[model samples]
Target: MQKKAGPFFYVFLALFVFFVMFPFLWVLLSSIKPLGELFGDKAFDWFTSHPTLKSYVSVFVNYPFLRYLWNSTVVATVTTVYTVFVAAFAAYAIARLEFKGKTVILGLVLAVSMFPQIATISPIYMFVKKFGLTNSYLGLIIPYTTFALPLSIWLLVTFFRKIPFDLEEAAKMDGATPMQTYFKIIFPLAVPGVFTTSILVFIAAWNEFLFALTINTAEKYKTVPVGIAMFQGQYTIPWGEISAATVIVTIPLVIMVLLFQRRIVSGLTSGSVKE
Candidate 1:
């Protein structure tokens, strides 16, 4: 029989949860604090005497924050779709196909992912400028897809390899074409991993700042991160507004994970064991 967790285990777990959640709780509390209270003597107090929605109101009214949010949604959604599509094909090929230098190719992909964006940003910017793609969705999409591809491919390859080859063989014997086999058989079985990869890719694209700031300098195309950064003025920073925006931007992602956490956990662990 498996052993039950002891009191110390529960204690440790509680501490871990506190460590993870304290920052967010502080930010949440800060977002609702009145500006005077935010800078007052009791600034570090857990709860404020005066709480107002003015910060949240300012986030929407004082700036074109809605447009910035829409821009982020567009870029992140498009980047996730194409990145997953292409990664699926590439991963399927690597996992199923017999080819020369397969290991080397995988290694190269990982190496490319490890390359710092700072090191390559200059060349990427020049390339985008040359094609007049700067300040466009395609410009950010191209780079987001590039950076996200390697991780997605790597994760999907593991899941694909976990699938039994006998399934593919059985499909072939029934006169199914390779494409049909993959679409009807392989793809459905791999949905968990695909879903997990999609969430991760979307988060990465959503939170991306350097490329978004660099490639899309046009105010209309600026994403949430850039928009939040711009909340600072000539001599003052709007801490409450920034905190409110942070809470607003983070809630959806938090809810998404909470809803799909089971699938995410299963997808991550399914490929861990050998069949």
Candidate 2:
């Protein structure tokens, strides 16, 4: 007979899922509730009572939300693209090429990734200001790429190492140059790793609050994280509006993860198995 999960295992799994989903469920339900229902003494009742999209409407109508969205999208897309491209080449070299001090360079890359970003923010700010990049997409994109590159390269390197070397040898035998081989052969095979890195870098850049708040002073240049944080005023916190904005910002990421769930799982499993 087939064995069933034990009671404790099922109970633990149920609790884990509930814990993971509770915050998202709360934000979603709160986003649809009216201000009165959200703030009323019987606030819990808001979940089942009249739901409305007034808060979502207010967010766009009362704020430069579209500008924030656009800035975030542009910065995130640029950062993700550049990071993935640079990291792919760097990882390919590290995985497939041999040179002196390669191990030392890889160790340094890993060490740099471990350093807290806050520690270098001041220096980064000064460098960006010197380059007159503040409040510009370049300001955010450069730093995002810098921070995301190390991890992306490392992760891609791990996956690239898992690929059989014979494929590359076969491609070279067909008169394919290294660049052509990378584009035509290796890149296609590294799709899972690339997608995994892109998702991670996009999410990191999207939710980045500290650097976005620090570097982008103009309201028009702000990202979603900074915009959402400043959505409230000194006099009051618009919980409904904040919650609505949170839901909006979160939905895209949730959808991306859901759509690429299989790829992410496969990528993670591949990394684990190879390691």
Q: Number of backbone collisions per candidate, in order?
A: 0, 0
Candidate 1 residue lDDT tens string, 1-275: 99999999999999999999999999999999999878868788889877899999999998889999999999999999888999999898899878998899888787887878898889889999999999998999988866788878877888888788999999999999989998999999988789888887788899999999899988888999998998889899999999999999889878998998887766556545664
Please name the candidate that would achieve the greatest lDDT relative to the true structure: 1
Candidate 1 residue pairs in backbone clash: none
Write candidate 2's Cα lDDT for 71-147 as tens digits: 99999989999988888888999998888887887888888888888998999999999999999999999888667
lDDT of 1: 0.88
lDDT of 2 at 25: 90
lDDT of 2: 0.86
- Top candidate by TM-score: 1
Residue 102 local lDDT, model 1: 87
- Mind sharing the TM-score for model 2? 0.90
In model 2, the worst 10-residue window by lDDT is 266-275
Give all candidate RMSDs, comma-separated: 2.1, 2.5
Off by over 4 Å in 1: 265-275
Structural similarity to truth (TM-score) of each candidate: 0.92, 0.90
